[model samples]
Structure formats: C-alpha cells, structure tokens
Target chain A: MTAVPDPTAELPVAIAARPAPGLGALFLTCLKIGLLSFGGGLSGWLYQEFVARNRWISDEDFASSLAISQMLPGANVVNLVICMGDELRGLAGSVACVLGFLVGPFFAVIALSALFDSLPDVTMLEAASNGVAYAALGLLLVICLKGVQRATKFPPGLVVIAAVAIAVGLLKLPLIPLVLVIAPVSVALAWRRS
Target chain B: MRDDDLVTLIAVFVPFSLLSIGGGSAIIAGIQHESVAVHGWISSREFIDLFAISRAAPGPGTMLATLIGWKVAGWWGALAASLALFLPSSLLCYGVIKVSNAHKAKRWHKAMREGLAPVGVGLVIAGVISIFRLSGGGLVAAAIAVASAAILTWMPRFPTLGILVLGAATTSALYSLGD
Candidate 1:
C-alpha cells in the first residue's frame, strides 16, 4: 500500500501511479469528505477521490472494501474509511481518518441543534434539505448503476443483486439473515464463474 | 451533566452500534425506541425535529446521537454518546481487517471479493429506497434526483457541491413561491 514516490528509485521502472497519501493528507481528505458530503452517497464520493482522481487505491480494491465495509456492522462510510486508512498508513492512519471524518459533524450537529429552537421556519429548511437529499440520491444511483453493470459480468451476479435488492429494499427484511441466506449462493456462483 | 446520563447514553448506543448492519439507517428505529420510549432522553416530537436537524447538517444522520446527547445533558453528553455510538463497531472493524488481511493473494479471497461486489450494489439500491421513503415519497424529489443523476452521468467532472446547492435553491424557491 505504501506507494510513496521514492527519490532514489530508477525512473525507468514502472511509472508510479500516484504519490502515497501521508497521514496528514488522509486526515484532510477525509475531513473534506465529511464536510462536503451532504445527504448520503458518501461511498461514491470516496470512490471519486481515492480511485478515480487520486489513484490511491485501485478500482478493484475499492470494490472489495465496499463489500467488506457493508458486511461489517457500522457506518458503511466509516468502515470504508477505516479499511482504506489502515491499508494506507496502518493504525494511526485509521485513527486520523476516523477522527477527521467524525469531527466536522460532531460539532455541526450540536451547534445546529442549539439553533433548532431559534429558527423561524423549520419547514423551509426541510424543503431545502430534502432537495439536497434528493440530489444526493441521484449521485448514489449513478454508482449503483455502474456497480450493477460490473456485477452482471459474473454469472448469477445479476440474479443475486436483484434478489437482495427486492428482499432488503422492498421487503424491509433484516439485513443479517438475508445476507446469511444469499451470501453463500452468491460466493459459490462467483467461484464457478472464476 | 449528570454522570449517570453519560453512562446511560453509552449503555444505549453501544448495542445499537454493533447491531447496525447495513449502516446507520438500520438501527435508527431501534435508537428511536430506546431514546424516546425506554430512556425518555427526548420526546418523540423532539426526535423527529432532531432527525431533520441531523439530516440537514453535513454528516451521517446517525449523528442524531450527538443531538440527543446534547439535549440530554450538554457538550459532555454529546461527546459521550458520539464515542459510545461510533467506537465499539470501529474497534471491531479494525480487528476484523487486521485478521482477514493476514492472508492475501489467495483464490478464496478473490471469490470473496467478487461475490461481495453485488451485495454492495444491493445495499446502494436499498439505501436509495429507504431514503426516498424517508423524504415522504415526493415526486418533486424524484424529479430532482433523476435530473441530477443525468447531469452527473454526462458531465462526470461536474462539481457535486454545485448540484446540491442548485437542488436546495430550486426546492426552496419553489416552496416559498408556492406558499
């Protein structure tokens, strides 16, 4: 994971993908993510930064991290941050990333709550925030579409995706049990396709 | 500011943290149950208001824990609740990554990686649904979402912040004019 641009290394070797993000860069990147990410779709934003723009992690690594983070019990965004942070710079890197991610909203929520009583029109804010959430959903849908197209290449992948979406999204089934039932079949199919 | 209040906040959120499979939205109802019905930290009305507040603020909606903690006590309560809510699962995640990461370049790992990709897609779809539901199923919201999606699809380099601002501005203008 350490991809720091080494000065002494020969330039004739494989071209460096990008400079490895140091702890400070990780914190700032995550901090920017925390502040800028209004609504949800945070995973998409992280993908844009780490995979598309920065070349910090490959597309496949991001995909696998998404899988791991979603499977584990926590904030999907937070879990991804931890996984990528650890991969980037070990335990301390994870700490910086997590703290950077949480710190902005920690104070923002409290401060906003204090102002909650003072606002003249909560409904107006509601209208605006609803708009924000809606737009964020659009961004998320784009990523969802991309993920679907990629997953379809593997056999039975589209079937698993549709089944899980129906069960969890429409039926509102509890995630753990649904995943428990679906995961083994999904993994086995992927193995066969491989 | 009571010590017991801090302890209570911790006691309540720790369980929700681990139980929050799929993400923070998963345990929102549970958090509501405990905070409103069980602990009486806040009323149901306050819960709704804070939910909006957390949503509007620039972070995860789960930061409702911070608002509730602030309401229950003050800054210290907010700190306590935030820690309790975020820490346990984080440690568990850290441990899991540390262990599973021990093996790499294996065939099973590749299978796990490929298999999990669709699962995340399933999750993104579910999140889109739940959040749509949360917004009272507004057709206007649906239109705005579709518009923004199209915008991003074509101009992948378009600044997202601009989209969000435009969304807020458009809705706010429409609502005020309608009113």
Candidate 2:
C-alpha cells in the first residue's frame, strides 16, 4: 500500500518512538514467558513483561492486540506475541519473539515427557504442577482485572463484558460469531464515549 | 521418520492451525480425532497422555501437536507439525496487525481499542475459568489462586517464581496429607 502522508497521523509515530529492544532481549523475554508459564496465564505474564515492565506499548494497545488475537485463527498467546512483536520491531521482531516463545517448550516438553515416561511416581509431581497452575491463575487474574479496569467507564462496556462472559463462558458459544456481534457494538459504544 | 507420516502430520495440522480460533484448545478435539481414530498414530489412551503432558509442559497447549509429531515421526515430524500448526495463522495474524498498524492514526483506532478491551477482558475471564476447570485443581486450588492473586496485587514486587514454588509446596503438602 502506498503511504498516504497525513499531518495528523501522530499516534503511530509516538507509539513507534519507544526504543526497540534488541532481538536477543526480545528472544530472552519470550523465552522467559514460554518456559515460566507452566500452568497457563501466559498472556498475563506477557503483559507483565512487555507493557508493564519495559513499557513497550500502552496498556490499551496490549489489550487490543489480545482482542485481535482472539478473533484470529491460532493460539491466542502466540498470536498476541506476533502482534506485539510486530509493533516493537516489524517482521524480524515477530520472528524472534515467536521462536523464543516456542523453542523452550519444544525441548522441555520432549525432555519432560521422557522423564515422565521413565519415572515411577509422578503423582506428587503432578500435584506440584497443578499447584503452579493454581498460582499462575493469580497472575492472570491481576492482568484481567487491569484490563477490565481499562475497558470501561461507561455501563455499555460493562454490558459488553457481561455479554461476552455469559455467552462464551456460561453458555459456551463460539467466539468468532460472538465477537463479530459484540465487537461492533463495543466499538460503537467506545466511539460514542471517546 | 516416514515421509508419508510426515505428510499426514502436515495435512492434519495445517487446517487445524487456521481452525484454531480463540486459542489452541479449540482444535484439540479435532487433533485427537485425526491422530487417534483416523490415522491411528496413537491410541486414545496415548492421546490423553500427550494432552496431559502438554498441560504439564510449558508453552502453548497446542504444543500437543508438537508432542504428537514427536511421537509419530521423530524430530523432523515434530518440526513439520508445529510449523504447519502455527505458521499459517501466524501469517494471517501478522497481516491483520500490519493493516491495523497502517491505520494507527485513525480516530477509530482508539475506539476499536477501547471497545475491544472489554471483550478481551471477558474472553480472558472465560479462558481463566476453562483452564482452571481443566486442571481440576479443586477447592484448595481455588483458595490458593485467590490468595495468590491477593498477594500479588498487594505486593507487585513479589517474585513470580517464589509464589509458584510456594504454590507447589502448599498444594503438594495438602495432597499428601489428604491421600
């Protein structure tokens, strides 16, 4: 696409102004996220690392990336990394991020599976892992709360949130359709509020 | 690794990659069906083992595909399967992001971000419930999760690794006692 130069187009420039982290740092960060997020809540940990720690992007950007990732086809966390990585450093950034994210688990899962196969007792081990999950949920909860806080000052946003939770979480609706229906309403509400 | 089995891995996972809406969990059932009932790469029992292992291991739950490939055809198979599963959707997501970036200056960008933020939060909560249920972590797990969340919120500086370690210790001790 040809670049349409617009004088008012300042938001992109400001967001893009944040110093790009080196590929190695990007890789390391993702590696930490991948290996450490054993019980889930990878996205929350991702928020903690990227937006919260490094200040790479605004909280709104992170949440929006997450929402976009959810609508797309792929693992939500991986898709999230892709979006954030792209924002940070273009294509190469995304490559480094996704590889760093996946490479550790590739080896760890194989090795752990081998270990599990050989070992006689994993009951305690399983319990421990579940414990890790229980705690990891805490991390996710914090991030979710933060996202919820950022989302709504108006009641409409709350309605959107409740609708999503009920339709998907309670009634077990498919996400894409729900998103297609809910997203427009949300965008409209946000448009009005903004 | 047999060439044919590798081909099968690619064919099976590529579609599922695109089908993985929301997250990797969306395709788990289809993956299981293909591997176990259709191709017979592994039995039903073995699929469960791999699922359990994927959960226990770090990274995306879709690493279940990686594990399946590892079992079916070895390292090359694992690589092929994972690439097939993740690459297509990654490309699509990347394109969408690029477009979104191009429109970064638009007024709607702010509105879209704000609007989707709540939806994202809701999906996140839904995901939390599902992941927690999958673990069958029970009441003790529930209590620990809430307590841990409280502690983390209160003390943002607290190291994550320490909390996780504490969780393991606490839960394992309780489990051993109950047993």
Candidate 3:
C-alpha cells in the first residue's frame, strides 16, 4: 500500500491547473470593466474585478503585480494585461489579455468620438461635463494619496526623498533640473540600502 | 479621409503614444505643440475645447486621438489614428511585462522598481506643476485647485464626477456673464 501523501506540495499545482474562465467570459468581463470605469476609477475597478470579485490570483500576488506594472513604462491598464496574462496562461494568456484590454477601450473611444459632434452644448450637459472633470481631479488625488500611503511604509529614506521631491521639485524648482538631482540621489540611496 | 491625411495621422500618434507617460494629461503639451503649433490642425481655442471633451468623457485621456482624428479626416481617420496611438504602447508594455516576469526575483528587477519610485513621483509632481502654470496664476484658478484638493481630502464620499460638473458649470456660468 502506498504511503499517505502530503497536501502542501500539491497546492500550487492545483491552483495553477484550476480551469480558467471561458475565453468568452474573460473577454466579456474585461469589456465590462473597460466600459463602466469612469472618471479615473479604472485601476481601482480593475482591482475589484480581478482580485476581489474573481479568484484568479491571490491578493498578495495581485498587489505585487500592480506595483510592478506601475514601475514599468506604459499605461497601467496595458501593464495589467501583462500581469493577468502571466498569471493565467503564460505568454499566450498575456497576448489575449492585452488584446482584450486594447480592443474594448479602442472601440469605446471611437464610439464616443463619433457622438462628439452630436452631443448637446446645452447648459445642463456642460454643467455635468464640468462636474465630471472636477471629479476626475478628485479621483486622481485619491490615487496619489494611496500611493503616498504605500510609499510611507517603505524605508524612511524614501519618505524623506518623496517629501523633498514634492516640496522642492513640485513647488519651487523647475521639473527637468529637479528630476536630474532627485533621480541620482534616489538611485544612490537604493544602491546603499541594497 | 485622404491617404496623405492617414499618413499624417500615424505620424502624429506614434510618437505621442511612446512619450505619453505618467498619464494622458502629461502629453497635453505635446498635443498642443502638434495640433496647434506644428501641423495647424486646430486653433488653440478648439484644442482647449477638445481637451475639455476628452477629460469630460469616460475612458483614457488618450482617447483624445479619436476626436482629433475625426476632425482631421472623418471616421476612418479617427479609427486608424486611434489604433496607431494605442497599439505601440500596448505592445511595448506586453513585451516588457513578459520579460520582467521571466526574471522577477533578480536584483535588477528590484533596482528598477526602487529607481522608478522617485521618477514616478517626479513625473506626477511635474504634471501638477504644469497644470498650475496653465491656470495662469489667477486667484480663481488657485482657489479652485486648493478648494478641490481640500474637499477631496475631507469629504472623500462625494463623487468625483459631481465635483467636476459643479466646477465646470460655475466656470461656464461666470464666463457667460462676462467675468
């Protein structure tokens, strides 16, 4: 008779092999997220849909993926496609996710542009549009606050750098010069810590 | 849309897509340079109006390409230009992510993130400063920024859409009354 097997080693494989949602389902879900997200809620909405509502990845995994994406050199949404793709289906999965992400937003923007000329220039509509802009600013501010909170938990040196960068770079000095100074300092600090 | 216009559309969008970092707003100066200054696609006033529409509508601010495209060459131009604008960034992002994941635990990956933190902060700060400059140092503009920031922090419950609408309405009304 065979000895009883341990369950721990089987867990990751099981999670990995767990059947993915159907392609149609995945596409629809992504499209829905793309369509409904408004006034800068896309990132948070994505987090909710992918991590909270769906169980494709663990919370820690999702957070790390998000952080990595933010660090990368593209729009956060596209970066998300890469993260989700890797987690779900490797290279092929990444392509599919990226395609889905791009197609929906592209078509939606086209549709909106088509309607641009016909959109009423009335007072109420104008008012509503203005309101949306301010709301967008507020949404962006909230996102920045979250970023700050996350950064604060890192080394105190980082917090100091961020503060100085904001006060001196944002308020006083020009951008190009400020970046030239801060970039080297930040790199040096990271090198020392490492 | 003329074929030549399609070529111009691609020319404008390809570089813009590559350089439009931080967010869509960060690329506004570039857009202004292209549309208002270089190609003369639209007047400055019209550019401002388009900017308003892009922000007012839902979805990414990069969607401004569609409207500008539409203005340049009609529906087909809009479609072609929008695709060109987004495709490069999306493809580049996908490739980067793929490679990064392959060696995620490496020191270079960690260093990249550590290095980027300051850069990201700098870019955002630059964007905020740029917007401040565009507000022309007017008291009303300064008040709007401060008040908006305060309200957002203190009453986080209020929907952002609502705030934007109120500000726009107040501005429009004031403008209408010859302020």
Candidate 4:
C-alpha cells in the first residue's frame, strides 16, 4: 500500500512535543472501548485504540503487554487497561482506566437484564445477540490470525504457538497448571537461544 | 446489600481473582460452582442468562460478577463483587508493568517477551475456539465470523462498529425469517 502521510508530521517539532495521555484521556478511551465493543472482542478493541489509532505504544509493546496481561490473573481486557494505564500515568491512570471501562458496562448489564425482562418477548433479540457474538469472534479471529502470522516467522515460535493451541484449545487443560508447566520452559528456551 | 452477603462475595471472589491465571475465563467454572451449587445465590437458569447478558453487554466476561451481585444485593452488590473480582489481579498487573518498564534491557525480560508471545497467540486462538463452541454449531455464525475477519484483515480501515452492526442486522434478519 502507498504510504499515507502522517498528520502529526505537519506539526512543528516544538509544538509536537506533546505529553503522554493524562488520566482523563485514558479514562475516556477506556470508556469508549468498554461501551462500544458489543460482544467478545474487548482485546481487539483495545488494540485498535492504543496501538492502531492513537499510536500510544508500538505494536510489539502492545503485544508483549497483551501476553503479560493474558498470562497474569483477572479479566484479560481489564488487566490490559491496567497495564496500559499504569504505563501512561502510574497508579492513578490504572484506577481511571478500570473505573471508566467498567462504569458503563456495570449499568449496561443491569439495564440489559431489566430491558429484556420488560420487553414483550422480542424474538429477534436473541438472534441479533448471537450475530453480534459471532462478529465479535470474527474480530478476535482477525487479531489471533495476525498474531499467528507474526509468531510463525520463527520456527520455535510456531511450535510454541501450536503447542499452546492444542493444550489449551483442544485438550482443554486447566490454565493455571498448563501455564505453570509451559511458561517457565518457554522462557528458558528463549533464554538459551538468546 | 446484607453485610454477610458482601462477606460471602469477598470470600468467593478474592481467591478466584488470584487463581484466575490466564484471565477470568479460567475461573468461570469455579464461579458457577460457587454461585449456583454451593452458595445458592442464583439459580442455574439465572446464571446462564447473566452469562449471556455479560457477553452481549461489554467489557469483561467477569462482569457476570456485577450481574450476580446486582441480583443478590442491588447496585452495591454489583460494585462489591466487581471490585473483588478485578482489584487484586489489577494490582498484580500494575506491579508487573512497573517491573517490565524499569528493566527494559534485562535478558530475562527479553526471554519473557519472546516466550510469552506465542503463548499469547495460542491463548487467543483458544479463545476463538471457545467462543465458537459457545456460539453453538451454526453455519451463519461461522460465515459471519469468516466474513468479518476477512473484511478486517484486508481493509484494515473498516469500522469495527459497522461490522458488528451489520452482523447483528444480518443475523437478526435471517433468524427472524425462520419459523
């Protein structure tokens, strides 16, 4: 594809030396992602905002953060926002992001149940929800495939990817034990090669 | 919310919060076990509905905690449960990020990054598989997934919200036509 001119390029260097996103910006962005992302694509939405759109972090940085978030405990997306937020504005940013992200969804879920209860048995609601869910899966598939594409460039990386997919996806092993078994070995192998 | 109910919420969610390595999906079965069977806080049917609503709503699947809390003790239950589920892991994530940022040039950091990348990829693919299964075996769902993915991959600029809306509309139309 032809190179699109970056809009930031037009700005004077002195003026362009902007600060990192403040807590408010982080909060709003997280809130937007939280409210808009309908189905199971919270991570994908996060990637879009932080990496793709805002250019807050490099793709590799985002990927590493993502890896760490997934490997650690809690909701993957919530952990992601925390990592990103902390990077941007320390503890306060982390707090803001989680609060902004969850605040909307908190009320939305409650409202949704109430709405469903109040409605006169709309037949199409479930169908639409399923579609949205599938589409969200599609969003996830796009990101996952891209991750695979990036990983497969190295043979060892490809092997690791395959091993994890089978162990977690197919075998359906308990994650904590699986990670305990796999993570250290993978890190050690990478350590040796490096 | 009753004082004891909040205590029970904290008791059940805190350990699961820490034990939820590889994200909240890992602890879902445990939550179900505690809520539906052990605690009798919500019935099995309500659990399923809340799960669906959580998926369809936004944010994390763990927001099922919020819904459960709402059912048990109104809005305060939602807040309490949400905090119990999210706060501990987030604190852990905050510490990890700080360490990683501080030691940018460390060899072990590099190793961790490299090793974790493929693992993350695998976990995401595993997520795709799980969502597919949860969606049930449907040709339409499969097709929407493939089509949306293709659009995202090739165009790279298509609005995700548009795709979601389109998917919902198409699926709604199709299902509404049946029976």
Off by over 4 Å in 2: A1-18
**Per-residue alpha-carbon lDDT of model 3 for A1-194, expressed as tens digits?**
78555443223311343366665556666666566555444554454456434557543344445544544445656676667776677767776666665566666665655566577755656544443343344444443454454456556435644654466546665444455565566556666667
Put down candidate 4 lDDT per residue, B80-162, tens digits, no spaces.
Answer: 89889988888888887887878868989888877776777777787788778877947888899899989876666778888
What ranking emerges by DockQ with the best candidate at the front? 4, 1, 2, 3
Best by DockQ: 4
| TM-scores for candidates 1 onward, in order | 0.89, 0.92, 0.64, 0.87
1 or 4: which has the higher DockQ? 4
Give DockQ per model, in order: 0.54, 0.51, 0.22, 0.61
Residue B88's lDDT in candidate 1: 93
lDDT of 4: 0.80
**Poorest stretch of ten by lDDT in candidate 2 chain A:** A8-17
Q: Which tens-of-lDDT digit does each residue in A1-194 have in candidate 2?
A: 78655433232312443587988899999998888888777887887788655668777778778889999999999999999889888999999999999999988888878987899988899889889999988877876777666555577877887788878877889889989999999999889877
Runs in model 1 deviating more than 4 A are A1-19
Query: Per-residue lDDT for B96 in model 3?
Result: 73
Which residue pairs collide in model 1, if any?
none
lDDT scores for all predictions? 0.81, 0.85, 0.59, 0.80
DockQ of 1: 0.54
* Candidate 2: residue A42 lDDT (0-100): 85
Order of candidate numbers by lDDT, starting with the best: 2, 1, 4, 3
